[model samples]
Target: MTWAAVSARRLARHRLDAPATVGGDPVTRRIADVVAGTCGAHAQVMSAAEVSVAMRVAGAVRGDVRNALWRDRTLVRAHGPRGTVHLMASRELPAWVGALGGLDADRGVAVGEPYLDPDQVAALAEACPGVLAYRDLTATELTQALADTVGGWAAEPVVDAFRDHLPRWRWAQPTLGHRGALCFGPNRGREVTFTSPARLLPGFVPMDGPPALRRLALRYLHGYGPATPAEFARWLGAPRDRCEEVFRELGDSVERVTVAGAGPAFQIAGDPTHHELPRGVRLLPYFDVFGVGCHPRSLLFAGGAARRALARGQAGNYPLLLVDGQVAGVWHQALRGRRLRVTVEPLVRLSEAESDELAFQVQRLAGIQGAEEAEVETGRVTVGPHA
Candidate 1:
């Protein structure tokens, strides 16, 4: 019922308390478990996602994530929650693909006149599976192929690129991915390539949409439990009504709970209601699932932590400093040749032991970044939001 108890369970579920370990090959399987346990790892900056995964698994190191992703084929990078890239468990990707594809495509930020018509969405989604099947293609190549198949309308650079120009087909890639028609292939030299789930897991087809969404909803509740439809929808970038439908579909699979700070919410049936008091200091990288999924803003981002750590209420805009499951500060890193420089700004005062814990995390971060050593500087973070 308390936020602390919920935080305790979440940390343990995420394997932050005891870095995840699996029966098979030490690093690869553990990497899969870590990704699967947390639903997925935000992979827009893959190296940081690797850091997120590595730091959660005992003795896991750099290259391990890439190994599982590209070499062992245990993980698949794809468009995941919130129309962003993520590393998902390859074996479980079908369900993820099904669940993601089930979200009402017209309900997100790109809705209204600016949004593509269903016919256009169908064209782009249809072209992706065959265009990228069993082959990797760069954005330009895919755009050209879509134009060839669907005409110039799909190729026009009409979409808002945010940072750069994006053709209509490229803009629809995320939606196509939700339909299991598109995913990330291994990078070709410096350029990124696209592929499809059909190519990745050839024999299997995706689970049905409703069932898959229910399955994912259950898992989400287990991982980020006692959460609201709005939060779940926010995470998946779906409309709140759609999430409410998914919740309703769950029916007896979930039950209502009144969290002390979070108020009324839904959690998986028969899940643990009581959890141990959370302890420890963690240096969570930007977009770390744990940081992004922290709920009940008032409790987890208490007082100064809110003012200091959050970037205009966005959780993953900056690296997080966690003290006993609450955001306590912000951190940023820069690499100098072989040495990694980590600067932390703790909003709350740290005891001597906590400071040492912070140092250990710095060392771990250096190792994960493939640096020879690390230097820690404790002071104000100086940078503004999204810096």
Candidate 2:
């Protein structure tokens, strides 16, 4: 078969392998399967933070709270993948984080924007002792508490300013609801709302060196398999050679398949089943890995179409509505009276049937996210629990 047909088939298979895919197993095993099945039995790695959060949410053997550091002995950490952090299995860190360059300068892409400069970060570390709960510490409280150690820097406004570097900042609250909301929780209303990094860092699985690289390649390949080195590099924010190295290491473990409609793609030896076209719509979170993973997103959407929709910042900044496995529109949600209202913004004009079909999908998403009901408005769609 021609490459396009081969790629299309691979794309279909990829849709089948995605985590939390619809109609899949409904057990903790499914979650574990998502992490393990994507790579292999030996490939159970995730960011320490991501793992901690995942475990807390999943209610693994330990209680939801995490500790200050995952590995108590290590003073230095080998963060991996895109210069950000991941909780790889202990065995995976040396090969993953150690192989790549350390502490990337492009904090926005890697470490994130509001990253604390050395002094400030150090101050944060030192202040951890005085910190009671993760509740939002006013910059003043943080500043006064750390004044001796941090020197002249003012702490109050600095805290607010820090937000520019770290948009996800929130004081750990005493209630579980606060903590869950800060992170992505399956359902709402738990206790221990405010959280500190300490509460979620231990679960970090650090993978360093070549093993890290190989694991990343395997994850990307399995999750987005049937892709080329270029595609993998773009998603990884790394070089093509690095991507190829990982693929080479795996060798025959990954099955290389050429797609017909989609061109060339790859797939794991055995993936779970998937749905046919019109599989249903998904409202993906902003900066969702899917969007950033594949640059020149035409690989998934219509060619030249992704950049236009994504460039808008506002529309591109929020959760997206994916219809039929393609990012067809953008959506937002707000609570209204007794229901949730959802606004849908289509990148392209839609026919009457298409609009109606999209509205139905938005309603479903609202229900899943805990809205009582849903309403759709024109121009832009907003999803809320009230009318």
Candidate 3:
């Protein structure tokens, strides 16, 4: 196999689960993947349309939209990898929290802005109910509530007050942001709902050290298997040996395979040929697992692609556009007034055909995201400071 094939195979294996088949129908395979790999984890940020397509392709529609919403797995807020919300697996919560021990504070504030003090943050934690639903609260309302409960401080002031505190735990998620609510509810009637930090805080739970780390290792290998101890350590923010222990426990259940040209590859024992590669277009959200699961860059993108993509610090600030299993460009969308603007920052200049293709894909994505209309634009790409 050539380098591309090897790369594709390794990625497919690490990201995909077992007893599955690919190369059949792209739509069908996609559904099987999102459901199987993440079912125990819970419903992620999949657009309603994507879910619908998968449901139709899989031939498994149990009820109407309302029922489907409820039937969907419970989504929860999680922390790890650059201090952002991730949709995490519920069954895997304990392991995730334990693994994330003490790294919470490193996440920093939004853009590293200093906000929220240790004592005040602790107070917020204490005041926080297990689950909080603002229903529809404006910034003012949220601030008012916080002030009412704690020293009557304003929201921004409250946040700024405790920016120096550090976290006492880490999460064990292979990737982050897959276990949270589907989307942020719009501001409504000065009240909105959200999962309280306390309910999702792993530090609240008592855990044994080694077992917790071991469980985290197993999940990472399961979802992002065929990986080395170094790669696992980078993703989990743990020591390499800790990850090795879990890999050791799995034994020969995992097979060692090398890309035709790429280095050694380890994956669950299964023919990767079973997975299909559809030309379907996807507007992967920021911090998509595919990019976050491995390190050393080579695992996902070509030599420099990973470094470039993540140049904006570890937490990716850009959304990548993938075409035919390669990094085509980076893109983002904004709904301004009545127009939907889709911007593409290409790593390389695009041919007319490539540009047109990108335009079409962006249009479709914008529609799915509930935009009234779409316009496409391209700009020079950059790998700069995350700040």
Candidate 4:
């Protein structure tokens, strides 16, 4: 089959939903769909994760995301791709757990000679579900419980060994939902807690690894496709050799495509060829999946946008300002009483239409943040780290 040729501009528009205006009847309604679309929503910065979902789902507020996580049991927070905390749908937890569990296992081996021996790690892992089986407990509480149940070593914060594993051995695993053992519970006071997914999301079944990795790779392509195996590996924090193995298994299900001005890439066989570039301006939250998910940094952040939007080669340090589907500037929001002050530092001058669209997006942002009013200030052209 002849490979389809796509432009970076069209890819951005398609991935970011550029043409769609805000405040419509929501292109995505369910919180699960929102999580699935971008593979998983980045939740390292909790507020940014909520805004990322709110931007796609109509009539969704930060509270809706909270309810889905804590009340509805539709979404669960887990350590996902790239070893980052992400909001994943409850139903999809099995596949994610399978794939990420494999990766974590590989990681454990690569790190070599665990602070706790195999038997000790195994013992702590075995004890974790029992300690957190029915009820949720904060990190401190969980740590103490593990120490009480497992021993003094479980309580020690083994920084070099892996900080995430300190509280409980199961925490070291990729998915807490694997045995329906745990899910992120509501924050108790200022501390986050974990509860049993079995209680929260009944009928949870973990899938096998091969099929789960296939599903994960497909979802990654669905949102950030026309990509390379190396890129996928980087995104998943898995070894490139492993990614290549999975891609080979995919076979003709994915096709090699040539991107204009870029080399070879791969996309799902039947993905849409025609995509409309988004118009006007959009405000993308810090760690917005669109900005972080796409690979070949050169293609997405070309025209010096990378220098302006990224800090020290790290994306998501600042929120992005998109003008016609391209990273044109960076923005920051501050709340003063009932009003939100949104300051934009553009890399290029904005046209009147773009400016108008920016103001509209600001209002939409204010609504998402629960601010009654907003003030948008577009400043002088400034690029790079300072911007």
lDDT of each: 0.84, 0.42, 0.45, 0.72
lDDT of 4 at 319: 88
- Backbone clash tally (model 4): 0
lDDT of 3 by residue, 1-387 (tens): 244554355345433212133346443333444433431222233333232223222232222222222223232334443334444433444555555543333343421223444455545544434114334334344446655666554243322114542221011111212122112222254453344333434344424545665656555655555567777777765556656666776677667766554567566656354334423233444555654564335535664556556654353445666554555566666667657787677665666776676776665555444556888877754443223
When summed lDDT is taken over every stretch of 10 residues in candidate 2, the lowest stretch is 173-182
Give the winner by lDDT: 1
* Model 3: per-residue Cα lDDT at residue 71: 29
Pick the winner on TM-score between candidates 1 and 3: 1
- Tell me how candidate 4 scores on lDDT: 0.72
Q: Tell me the deviation in Å of residue 335 in model 4.
A: 1.6
TM-score of each: 0.94, 0.54, 0.58, 0.87
Estimate, for each residue in 39-156, the C-alpha lDDT of model 1 and write its tens digit: 9999988878989999988777878989999888889998888878999989888888788776644454443236467778877878888888758999888889889988888888
Clashing pairs in 1: 101-178
Off by over 4 Å in 1: 22-26, 105-115, 162-164
Compared to the true structure, candidate 2 yields what TM-score? Answer: 0.54
The number of clashing residue pairs in model 1 is 1
What TM-score does model 1 achieve against the real structure?
0.94
Off by over 4 Å in 3: 1-3, 6-73, 80-84, 98-218, 260-262, 271-282, 303-308, 312-315, 348-356, 381-387
